[model samples]
Target: MFDPDEIRGMLISAAQQRMALTYSEVLHALGHRFTRPLMRQLCKVLDAIDEDGRAAGEPGLAVLVVRQSDGLPGQGWFVARSGSHADLPLDWEGTEARRYVEARQGEAFDYWATR
Candidate 1:
């Protein structure tokens, strides 16, 4: 019985710490079992957070979650602050996280410049 807010907090903490986490890692951290419905709910919550951040003009705080094709863990997520050059953890997988930030560079700049 994991709360969505708890998951959101975990993501924020991970971003602040400049780390990435897999779905399994998140589940283990919460002491929860793996279930498809829970996974779907997590994804939905992440999407809502992303939208909310964008609407608030603080879009860079959004975490990027990607489904991996490697089949080991199946999915992973990362939080990368805009303009940060901090190195991600060695265990962090996927180019999607980096791509996610790169994709939003212009929007982030625009938001900050207008603020």
Candidate 2:
């Protein structure tokens, strides 16, 4: 079983290594410490934080992140339109997106890093 402290430590370490961690990355960092449902909830909270840029406000988009067995966070970046207009295609290159995901995931755990 994963202790809360252990999970916290892992998150901190990941955050420092990657710079920031995405919502899904946070859950993935938790590893076996939390169940899938619990991770989902965490992801929701993380998204809320991301969207609001604060601790409150409705999410601008709904994204699903699948957990990988290798302990790395798998990202599926999906953006939804806030209005009736169609969603814009992501222009970020694959490598850049991957880097962004890793950095965000890193932020999820770094205690020293300010959100």
lDDT of candidates 1 onward, in order: 0.52, 0.42
| Per-candidate clashes, comma-separated | 0, 12
Alpha-carbon deviation at 24 in model 2, angstroms:
10
Per-residue lDDT over 26-112 for candidate 2, one digit per residue giving the tens place of the 0 to 100 score: 555656354666665665454443455323432221222334442323332333222322433343335544554445444343433
What lDDT does model 2 reach? 0.42
- Could you tell me the lDDT of residue 73 within candidate 1? 26
The candidate that achieves the highest TM-score relative to the unseen native structure: 1
lDDT of 1 by residue, 68-106 (tens): 344122223333222243543334345654554445443
- Per-candidate alpha-carbon RMSD to the true structure: 9.3, 7.6
| Among all candidates shown, the one with the greatest lDDT | 1
